[model samples]
Target: MKVKQKSICETCRKQKIPCDGTKPSCSQCRLRDLCCPGYQSDWIFVPHTAQSDRHSGATVVSQSGIVGGRKRIKDPRPNPKYQGARELTVPRVLGLSVSHLMTLIIRSYVPEPELASLDSNSNGANTYSQPRICGCWVEVLPNLIAKGETVALSSAVRAFAVSILSGGPMPIASLASGLEAYSVALRSLQRALRSACQFRDELAAAIMCILLAELLLPTTLNSWAAHLQGFGELMQLSGPELYTSGIGHKLFVGARPSLVILGFLSRKASFLGTDEWRCLPFGLQPPSAMQQLLSEAAVIPSILERLDKASGLPPRDRAIVDRESLHDFVAVLGRLGQWETYLQSADQYPLSWVKADAEEGAISCRWFNNITDANVLTHFWAFKVICLQNIDELAGNHPGMTSSSQFSTSFRERVGLSVMISQSIGYLMQDEMKLFGPSSVIMPLRTAYDTFRAGSSQCKVELRQCNEIISGILERGYHFVPLFFEAFRDAQFCPMSV
Candidate 1:
């Protein structure tokens, strides 16, 4: 029998070069003046199979000399390091992986400064330590989802992030996935609430997350109302105790804008008017001038609600209601004037109105010249406009309301104020669309757009500019911008006489 040739040295075989089968040293190695790497008895040459066979979804020897097959099953046991980790059974949605999805969600929801803080803090003593409550949903929650814990909340968070990523009008499949995730999250939340689970904070955070997802869904009005109401109730249930913690306080403050918007939309004062809600921290003492201004501004929504309810009464009843409301309206005007005076006097938050020539008209505008604090200025002016809008509504709609020259002058002044604020916002938004994302000033911009006199050519031009900025926001994946745009269009067609 012919003797089988000895296998080539391991190094030569690995290098895919011919190796003369020598016991002490291969000819290839000796010729190269290199140490002979020892050979294995089991070494054998194996050529790659046909492409068709390679992709048949079966095991094969890979190019790297390892046996390749379908993905291996992950171990079911919880990691000792991650005590509560659960393996997710629900398959990840196609296209993006879990880690990628988590990254996108974190970037979209978490503020840049807060994220930077998290990054800096990550290198501390415990690398795997849990982040604050504000971060828990975006950071720790993803890991929990990967381990298959809190599926509902995770699904909702994922759906919201995916919806945002899809931008514009979402694809049908993506919409379906979002809806399904939302459904799962809602049901899971209910179950957790009913059960005796120890993790109340997690559940509370989930409720907030679900609320965020609902907002992204651009859900029906009733659905949005329900989510807001549910969140309000959940926050109440958590009580004042929740606000005592640093994370809790941060979350509470962050949620204030949503609460204000929801309160305005629902025409409900109880959301913000409640003693419990008011007891929550507004700011550290001595409060910033901006904080003081916001605190006073927050009361305007309730006043508007009162005016709205009064407007719905019969002429006779409305006259009585209007008389009572007139006092409140005058009081509000006084308060607003006082705030404006305070804003003017406070050196800390200095504001000045500069006259500028616009294409449509000459307008007096107040904006923060400081680029960094422009958003604060936007909120300040926006709140002022909102207060003025309510005052205008109350003054114009009440049956007993006098059209006296005094009232007319007040009304004219209010109109001028609204115009100035709207134009200023338009200019600011135009300049800072990239700096402050579309959603940052969308509500206030929408309010300003709607409140501006529809018939004025100047107002119309300013409104068009605002719409362009909103459209830009829409192009950047804020689908909800269009809804507001549509509402503005409706307001234009059927202008609110009030």
Candidate 2:
């Protein structure tokens, strides 16, 4: 029994590359160093016949025309009505814009079977594949878009998708498209807010998408902060109960870090500091290590709020406020320290702590296991810095409350933590880990920058380093970073030491 050969091999056909019509395997596959799965056997080949088909009125094209013996029609375009027998294919995203391509691709990327594979077992061992940040972008937004429940959400998602597809350092075209989509999303969101028509979950998801767009491609300095304020309002409307399960719960968990930052920006107590928010979002499940750390950090903003109020009081009243705030600050600092110790003691914390760098024969630095670890650790340090600096300020103002020696020690510890953040920059900016994006370091690095006075030598060094990282981030297409830098440049969030 003889078998018929195919015109192309499977590998070449899948790649959309030209295949040399070969029998066993194509030379293109060998040239490209790919294993050639031989041609599929399902196809039935039909040989050319000279006789005209009467059943379908099909006319066979001959090699030669009777006008001239053995003369072929070299160009077939003139015969517009004649169609080829072979199958014709085009690339999936060939004619669509980048944003459209992203929309279609992500929506279909994960099916039920693939999503189920993400459920890893105990001990952090996964027998199946999953994304690094599970269910946030790949799963959640796509699923929401699939439902088509809200236009606001779909538009916001397209805007975010464009940013991700750009892979940082977004081009002018993508930038314009993303901004246009973002504008549509913003308007749709406003309409949704006005009419009070969209479901709480859809509205919340749209707001989350808008917030991410601002972070990725912000038009104004306060856009991210402003959107965060709106997100806070929605959270209030839905209440903590709404976030106890499903998509609402995921958005709340994701928004926690941003809300904590919002507390710093507003210099006011945050809702996240309340017992309900701190404990309820996790529902029956306990908060993860990061979540617990975030809860501890959320308290710092309230301390700042109290400190602000205390500063405005009369001397007698100020003293009373100072003492209470001092105790609160010290306790917050202690809790943050405990969290740090516990994290460092965890097995996963030090996957491979090799020496990453040595600066001028002093102060060796270590790279973290991944961007997640480094980012979380730096954030922990930033929160501690805020608490320690505030404590130092309140104690110094009260003079008799804290000794000068103790103040100096607190000052030195905070400075050390700031330097530690700078040390982690090298690890965070690595190209390999860029999937985590440069947005992770924006708040933490900015916090690290505030630890030193404007004219101090240390301040100059940290400023230059931060500027370089910000430049790298922008070059990678996170254009909104400079806007954040400008907004935070003279921010009065922290009390600078003398």
Candidate 3:
């Protein structure tokens, strides 16, 4: 039989094998039992007519025996609407993204329920005021940054986020980016502050972001004070109108703890005690009983300031000042006692003894059990220690005399209180630690650590445990931990084993 010469089948061509060029199927496909994909016929050469003409590179013949070239059609481009259809979907806040980590850090400061609700809502707007609700900044900040609503505030948030991330085993690139963001944010904040009218909310938010950043990031001790001061100035400048809004209320409530700490550290009254704060509805209501205690505790600083001034005077002069300040001191103590009574009676935080197995012995630890309650109790005890320390100072007792057998009884009591506070702190959730921030625990822990006697085993053990907790906090990517650890070391009566 004569073999026909034809184009190779499509399947044979694709397989790069020779074809028998059969009409129905290729020999290779037939022999292998594979279905053949038929091939197109080869183009046939045709003689062109004299009347044919080229039009747009294509040959054509008119009815009048004139040939013209057909216009070449361009391939259609993809529709812009469907161009991104095949792209992989991603969350707005991916783990590596600065904004994503910021959202995590910010959410850490907020309650879980609020975070869940915020995640569920498309808009994430705060429609109502609830004590347990997460701050509006936590929900709104990521969106604001995404939308480029406020460059200064967004940069500040990014700076803060990157700084927190820098504490972890991050790439060198991330550390450089964090530094760049910090520089940009600081410069932007200065400009924003200069043009306050245009960037009121942005400026306020930036102040808060920077304040929190200062608290969490490695900085000079009490560097957050400047930001807190600026925040207060801005709030005063903006007036009550600012606090009336939902976001404003969230910002104020979220920042109140820092303000209280600043007040104590500065030995002055908290700005939250001002009439402007008093006038605002949200400001009038403390978020929790603990917050109220903090606000009330602001008076301690003012009283201490007076006592310190009085102690510096001549004996005759000091006696007059002391008598005059006596009434105020008594009233402040009375208020503090009332707070203690309320705390004792508060059913929300039930006290419990937690027994844990330790190397020394089976230690029974006293804690409120609840994280917030434990934090509050710890702070309260620290405050009491401060009160006692101050009272001791006012009574002409030398600082070095605390270890004397005569004063040893009170010293032991203080030491026991400090131990309990440290133990309570260990029970706090990682989320609570972030929410409260390092500033919340630093002073209390320092106060507790200061009560220790040099070379005392109990004191050394407590310091070691506190240091371990601080180390855990460091591992969690809080940059402030190392600074706090340094402060703890500086304040330690003697070198601790840990």
**Most accurate candidate by lDDT:** 2
Q: Per-residue CA lDDT of candidate 1, range 1-498, in tens? A: 966445678778778898766534567886788877645555332333456336643232111111223321111221234343221211222234444444445544543434443345432111212122123334444444555546555555655554543321323223544555566678777787788344354565566677656656646546766876777777776675566444455455545656666666556675555444654564231323444444565666676677678767788897676667666656755776787677567555455455454444433355554422444455565665555555555567653465555555654554555555555554454422322334455555666666554435545665555565555555544555455445544644312111
TM-score of 3: 0.65
Clash totals for all models, in order? 3, 5, 2
Candidate 1 regions off by >4 Å? 1-103, 110-115, 123-149, 168-176, 196-199, 280-294, 311-317, 337-372, 397-436, 453-458, 485-498
| Backbone clashes, candidate 2 | 5
- Estimate, for each residue in 163-229, the C-alpha lDDT of model 3 and write its tens digit: 5433322211234444555666888888877776643655667777666655544455555567677
Per-residue lDDT over 362-451 for candidate 2, one digit per residue giving the tens place of the 0 to 100 score: 434547765456657788888888888887888778789889999889877877777787777666655444324355666677777667
**Root-mean-square deviation per candidate:** 16.7, 17.2, 21.6
Q: So what's the TM-score on candidate 1? A: 0.62
Off by over 4 Å in 2: 1-138, 163-168, 172-174, 197-199, 348-365, 454-463, 487-498
Arranged by lDDT, best first: 2, 3, 1
Name the candidate, 2 or 3, with the larger lDDT value.
Answer: 2
Clashing pairs in 1: 86-147, 86-148, 87-147
TM-scores, one per candidate: 0.62, 0.69, 0.65
Q: Which candidate is the best by TM-score?
A: 2
lDDT, model 3, position 388: 56
**Count of clashing pairs, candidate 3:** 2
